[model samples]
Target: MVRLGNLVNAEGRAARAAIVDYGYRTGLLSGLAPEPRERQGAWLTPRRLAILKLIAQGQPDRKIATAVGCAPKAVTTAVHHILRNLRAEDRAHAVALDHQQGLLTQPLVPLPEHRPRRVFSALEAQLVEALAAGQTKLQIRTSQGLSAKTVSRLLTGAAAAAGVRPRRGYAALVDSAYRGRLLTARAVDRASAPCLPERQHQVLIGIAHGWSDEQIAHRLGLSTATVKTAARLLYGTLDVATRAQAVARGWDLRLLGAPRPATRATARPGAPSRAAA
Candidate 1:
């Protein structure tokens, strides 16, 4: 029986190789191969691409508007268009997608000479380093001779400059540490294991389905504010700063069901169809 199984596997391999050889010869395989949609970077105009570059640099809408010689409202509109074109959920997701597509390889436009760079104070720098090292705020306060309010203020300021939520500073720091190979596997495990409640689980599933707070609230028979608060809490628990990241993490953890696969459109009865290879 084992010999028969091996022979069957060998036959399958031979058949696959034959199909591959035929595909290469006929030039049909390339046409049928799936490519990432992000490869179509030409869809964005120069101005829109410039805005995306600024966003990648963590520039606010106002800053981007000034850099692009447009009003804040115009920047907002451009961002919406960029998001829609990229099929991204938000600015952060758009920036991430741009990175994935290698769209930010070149500097889009030079920053204005008069623009001031964001600077962190010595204490704030220490706080950020401590947070990145996985130290608690209380521990940082004790070691740095600072009060809770001072630590909070400094951390908040740093998070704002970095374009991340204040509470997400620690997670961002952890992510940096992991990327830099400074964190041990055990430490990563500890940080990644966040305790989530049943309600939060449902909320995450709703988000995975692309439901807004108002929609989730209506479906769950809860107030919009309640759903919003739950989402915030969910973000904190998952150590993610954005809704897109939360949904991705949920999918990674198998907390949410797999997305439905896209189906090909049916051809009309009289239309010509390509022969199946």
Candidate 2:
């Protein structure tokens, strides 16, 4: 119901992913997914599969480094390599790939009941909110004064508070935090300004969501002129002239979530490049 002029439905994507995960759990989705390349068996060495387990278990790079007897950066690099080997898009996708390949035998653990909302320090607040908003690791680090290692540390702390363990994995811990309210997602309007009126905040969020002015008007129950007028005020508040500039500034100020990635039907024909992830 809370649509900031149809802010990209990240929750919708998660739900679809959940359905796909269910299909995999029931041995019903493998045929639908891409068949594994022949080189896969050679690629997933024992070391790589072990690392994947640590990832699923919610261990961050630093902890993974400690356990794996490698540097934290090495853990990151190895994870990237593992993703390439599995032809996975992200950690969660990598988990699914491993399961389909018969490498990861254990099923995902069910989440426990909701816990009360937990208070966080300012940094923790920004990081968690950015993550929930689907901001990339790079976006968070560059905009919010956090490093990848620090992010990991914060995740571990939150996971511990939520009683998330290896059986539940890293993604499980994030889900648990959401259920327990240890993490909170920002309404695009939560990125509002002090000087702007409430309606203008909605307008700004709508703009950030890539809504046409008419669409914003329809969603907010206002005339198109009213929406345009509000957008003018929004531009003034942000000290920007165009819609694109306002959005760019919003991202810099941590007033907006991460931009969505471009969707593709297939991977490009080349080695997977390193990602911030």
Candidate 3:
């Protein structure tokens, strides 16, 4: 679970950004490695980090150009320059690396006029305003006649200011998030991929409450299959098969909210036992 401190703490936020950047840079950092004091190719620079911050903010090349008073193509050119310096594949990857390096946590120090600034589109700009106003995607989509997917894209584009990829589709995002959690938990274990003990119990409780896979997946940024897989894994860990058994054992183990025996609902008829099985 990403606690508020994860974002609120300056050190934690920088570390997170750097980790993400590092993950994207995997298998792509050859020339970009840190050089010895005598050796030289290219290194991560403030200019690169600035570009990354803009990309994360969802600024388009044109807007970035305008903000920096450069040609629209200049934005792309600047990005390529930054990538070469960082030995990254693309803007996204560079931004991810920046996040991982904690380069973004520091206050924004404006560059000289020669440096570029980021720009946003009217629509994209509006989206951020709406989000800041606490608007929901459904509401924004309805009012703007934009598809939910578009709204999501816009949000991602906006949130990318810090370089995190806005989850693409709702389904994909759910799966990614689910997988992310499992991976995170596994990272903690190192020897095996394990679900967090606490999360497994919470998931079981949510399932017992008749929450749909989509709902759970959306809330957890996980896919339906991941949810089911995690459930199965939890069951295996608990020596149970059925949801009831899992829930029963989970509750007994105090892994879940107090069990509600009255809510002995069964899986919906015709629903497959395993996702994508």
Which parts of model 2 have CA positions greater than 4 angstroms off? 1-38, 106-277
Query: Which lDDT tens digits does candidate 2 get at residues 112-132?
Result: 332323334445545545554
Q: What is the TM-score of each predicted model, taking all chains together?
A: 0.28, 0.28, 0.25
lDDT of 3 by residue, 80-178 (tens): 777676666665565655554545564323211110012233455465444423355777798899987888776664333212234322212211212
Q: What's the count of clashing pairs in each model shown? A: 0, 1, 20
Which pairs of residues collide in candidate 2? 56-169
Q: Which scores greater on TM-score, model 1 or model 3?
A: 1
Backbone clashes in model 1, listed as residue pairs:
none
The residue-by-residue lDDT of candidate 1 on 144-229, one tens digit each, is 99888988887776544333445432443322222222221221253456656544665665654445677667655557886787
User: Candidate 2, after superposition: displacement of residue 23 in Å?
Assistant: 8.6
Tell me the whole-model lDDT of each prediction, alpha carbons only: 0.53, 0.53, 0.44
Q: How far in Å is the alpha carbon of 81 misplaced in model 3?
A: 1.3
